[model samples]
Target: MTTEDSARLAWFKSTYSGNEGGACLELATTPNAVHVRDSKKPTRAQIVFTRQSWAAFAGFTGRPR
Candidate 1:
């Protein structure tokens, strides 16, 4: 998506993020894709994932590879 499209998303930070300047991420979801970016740098490029791919990744992460 274009910058304009991304600007329209309602981004949400992960609940796991703390205020101590540790690793933080934000996510915004649409019917077609999931947008991910560093919470500290909202203007940076994002990693977009398809619904199926994101679902698989969400399920696989923090688990044994």
Candidate 2:
């Protein structure tokens, strides 16, 4: 990803992300897409999800603290 893309990306860690920094999910919002990827591999192929689908997933997963 280019610096512009990286800079434009606003990433959020999954609620389930471990405090110890193990496996974690990173979320980034784009104008027309949402980017999902492993924190451990920020440069790897990012999984793109639509806004609606992402919302559905978040709802389905729910918040489990």
Candidate 3:
């Protein structure tokens, strides 16, 4: 996505992220994609994943390790 497109995304961080942040990430979702970026560096490059791929990743992470 272009910088302009990224700028239009409503990015938000997890509520668990405290004011005294160490390593936090932000996410924005669309019908087709999920955008992820470092909370401390919003201007940096983001990682975009298709909705299906993101769902799979989320599901995997939720499973017991």
lDDT scores in order: 0.89, 0.82, 0.87
All candidates in order of TM-score, best leading: 1, 3, 2
Q: Is candidate 2 or candidate 3 better by lDDT?
A: 3
**What TM-score, computed on C-alpha atoms, does each candidate reach?**
0.81, 0.72, 0.80
Off by over 4 Å in 1: 61-65
Better of 1 and 3 by TM-score: 1
Q: What's the CA error at residue 19 for candidate 3, in Å? A: 3.6
Cα lDDT tens digits, model 1, 4-63, are 888999998888788888889999999999999997788889999999999998888686
Cα lDDT of model 2 by residue, 1-65, tens digit: 66468656889998789799799999888777788988887877788888998888777856674
Better of 1 and 3 by lDDT: 1
**Predicted model with the maximum TM-score:** 1
Off by over 4 Å in 2: 1-4, 61-65
Candidate 1 TM-score over all chains jointly: 0.81
Assess candidate 3 and give its lDDT: 0.87
What are the per-model numbers of colliding residue pairs?
A: 0, 0, 0
